[model samples]
Target: MSRIGKRPVDLPSGVEAKVSGQTVEVKGPKGTRSFTATDDVTLTVDDGKVSVTPRGSSKRAKQQWGMSRTQIANLVTGVSAGFKKELEINGVGYRAQMQGNTLKLNLGYSHEVNFDVPQGVTVTCPKQTEIVVEGADQQLVGQVAANIREWRKPEPYKGKGIKYKDEYIFRKEGKKK
Candidate 1:
């Protein structure tokens, strides 16, 4: 039995969900997001809640059961409260700023790197060393933050790089004679 699949996703006030065939669409104040589930599971919405159930007692069906449920839950949360990701710069010369729709990053490189912001997502640099990504889609927000961090990953030698706000960098011993 799938524990998570059994729990229905409750819709909050001011949020609306519409399930059609294998697709579910959720609309809220932030935005509208939709997901298409596989044929292994069935989706049903009732009483301002959404539920997922497997059609057969099989491995694939059970797997889809939980995954579909979580996907629906994410849609609900995404449309309602939205999502956000924060990044912090740790290097001395590393910094970031917003220029119109583009993000300019200086990560100890010979030249400044320009990052073009994607649609449906908002990137803000409240401080030169801080980056905040916000959007209705959780995956997009997270992916944007990761891409920014990839330019300068935190190293063990000096830990001079970009990283998540709550991330921890393990310090390593320096070379000595």
Candidate 2:
């Protein structure tokens, strides 16, 4: 049995969800997000909650059961409270700032890298070493943060690069004399 699949996703007060065939759409104060699941699972909405069930007892159906349920739950949480990802710069010359709809990053490179912020997502820099990405869609917010971090990934030795707020850098021993 699928433990997670059995639990229905409860809709918040201001959030609403609609299940049509294999597609689920959720609307809230932040924005509207939708997902289309595979045929292996069935989506149902009732009594201010949404549920997912497998169409059959096959292996694929069972695999999708729990996955579909979590997807629906993400949709609910995303629309209601939205999502965010924070990045921290750890290098001396590395810094970030916002310019209109663009993000200016100085990650020890000879030239400052300009990152264009996409629509539906908001990128902000409260400080030179901090970057915050916020949006209704969790995937888009995470992707934007990843793209920004790609310019200067954190290194294991000096750890001078961009990294997540809660991420830990595993230190390695230097060369022996």
Candidate 3:
């Protein structure tokens, strides 16, 4: 039995969920999101709750059972409360700023890196060293934050670069002279 799949996802007061075939769609104040589960799982919405169950006892079915349940839960949360990711720039001259729909990043390079914000996700610079990514879709928000951090990953030597706010860098000792 799958622990995550055993629990039904409850729809908040303002959130609504619908099921069609293997697909589940959720709508709330933030936005609307949908997910399609594999044939290994069955999805159903009942009385402001979503449930997932495996179609068989195979290993693949059990795997899909948990994953499908989680995906459906994410859809509900995405539409209701949304998702957010934060990035921190940790270098002397490294900074980020929002220019219209573009994010301008100065990561010690000769030229500035211009990252075009996607349609669904929103990127904001609360401070020069801070970047916040927000969107209704959890995957999109995380992807956008990762793309920004990829420009300059934190180094073990000086720990300088873009990184998640909760991330910790493992520092390496310097070579002896």
Candidate 4:
């Protein structure tokens, strides 16, 4: 009954998927990733595609059906093409630089904010104001970008802070003179 669950995730060329118990592992040229589905849903990889079906007609089963399918799809996409997120700093003195495994941030704060890059995720600063997060895990890449953005979220008035490349901050009018 789940729309997303009904569609099978097709494996791209040169990508391989293996099913072991409730877990599905995908391997590709970029990297390898795995996902474990809840018991409420059954996972299967056949031919060149993966499918998910609910074990019963319960709410939890249906919930897991779609979620499990998406997770599996993300695993495939992640291993194949990987994932990336970009952030931009928009303040006068705000900037970011990478020091080996650490990301040094100057977000107009009293002291510089040093963000330690976690395993499985690569943080790079192509420009002083641009940050790029890359990884095979979609969640980790997104979470790393979010954590960096949290240091200095864009303000509504001047919109001076860090934000995603495609994000738009709503501006508010200044106080009356």
Candidate 5:
């Protein structure tokens, strides 16, 4: 049995889960999310708890089953407590700001990059160099953060670019004159 799959997921208060067919819908204070279990995986909700089991004994099936369960659990937690990602600008002229529903970023480019913020997610710049992204969907939040980071990944030579607030990028020394 899979250790993570064997553990039951505890549903928090104010969060409601409904299992209909192969799709599981989770509703909470933040928002609602739904996920479908694979054919080799089965999920059930009982008394505010969720359980996942494999439909077959094959190794691949078991792996899918465990992954399905983890995805469902993350969805439940995300809707209940939400998710957050913090980013920091390292370049000299790099900065970010919120304008209406869009996030405009200046990453030393000739023109600014404007990213549209999707519904159910919020992006804020607490400080000039700090950015915070929050949402009820874990996947969406993470994807957005990744997209932002992709604009200007940290360079190994100078460690200058956009990166996660807690992320560390190793720097290499420049050539001697």
Candidate 6:
């Protein structure tokens, strides 16, 4: 038995959850998110809560059972409270700006990088160096932040590049003369 799978997911007020066959959909004040469970896992929603049960006690079944439950729970919480990712630019010439529904970044490259903001997701910059990404789906918000960070990952030698807020990058000393 999986401990996480055995736990029931509590639906917050104003959030609705529906399970149909292999797919589960959760709608909240922020937005709606849906996910399909694995074939070995079954999902049921009732009485303001959700549950996940495995078809058998096999190892894979146990793993899937826990994973499916966690995923569903994340979906519910994401739609209710939403998700956010913060990034900081740590170089002299590095900066970012929002143009229309796109983000324009200058990461010491010859040409600027432009990324389109997907629907249901919002990006904001309180300061030039700080960027925040918000969305109702945890997976999507995280993936978008990762893609932006990949454009200019922090370097070890100078520790200058884009990185998540509160992230630490080890710095290397310059070569001896």
Query: What's each prediction's TM-score?
Result: 0.97, 0.96, 0.96, 0.95, 0.94, 0.94
- Per-residue lDDT of candidate 4, residues 1-177 (tens digit): 999999999999989999999989899987888888889988888889999999999999999999999998888888888899999999899999999899999998899999999999989899999999998899899999999999999999999999999999999999998
Candidate with top lDDT is 3
Question: Per-residue lDDT tens digits of candidate 5, residues 1-177?
Answer: 898888878899999899898899999998889998878878889988988888889998889877988898899889888899999999888999999999999999999999998888899998878889999888889999999899999999988899998998988999999
Tell me how candidate 1 scores on lDDT. 0.93
In the order shown, the candidates' Cα RMSDs to the true structure are: 0.8, 1.1, 1.1, 1.1, 1.3, 1.3
In model 1, what lDDT does residue 93 have? Answer: 81
Candidate 4: segments with Cα more than 4 A from true spot: none
Q: Which is superior by TM-score, 1 or 3? A: 1
**lDDT of candidate model 2 versus the reference:** 0.92
Give the whole-model CA lDDT for all candidates, comma-separated.
0.93, 0.92, 0.93, 0.92, 0.90, 0.92
Measured with C-alpha atoms, the lDDT of residue 60 in candidate 3 is 99
- lDDT: worst 10-residue window of model 3: 73-82
Q: Please identify model 5 stretches exceeding 4 Å from their true place.
A: none
Give candidate 5's TM-score.
0.94
Candidate 2 lDDT, 12-127, residue by residue in tens = 99999988889999999988989999999999999999999899899999999999899888888888998999999998878899999999998877899999999999999999
How well is each residue in 1-177 modelled by candidate 1, as lDDT tens digits?
999999999999999889899999999999899999999999888999998999999999999999999988988888888899999998888899999999999999999999999998999999999999999888899998899899989999998999899999999999999
Runs off by more than 4 Å, candidate 6: none
Clashing pairs in 1: none
Per-residue CA lDDT of model 6 for 45-131, tens digit only, reads 989999999998888989999999999999988989999999999999899999899999999989999999888789998888989
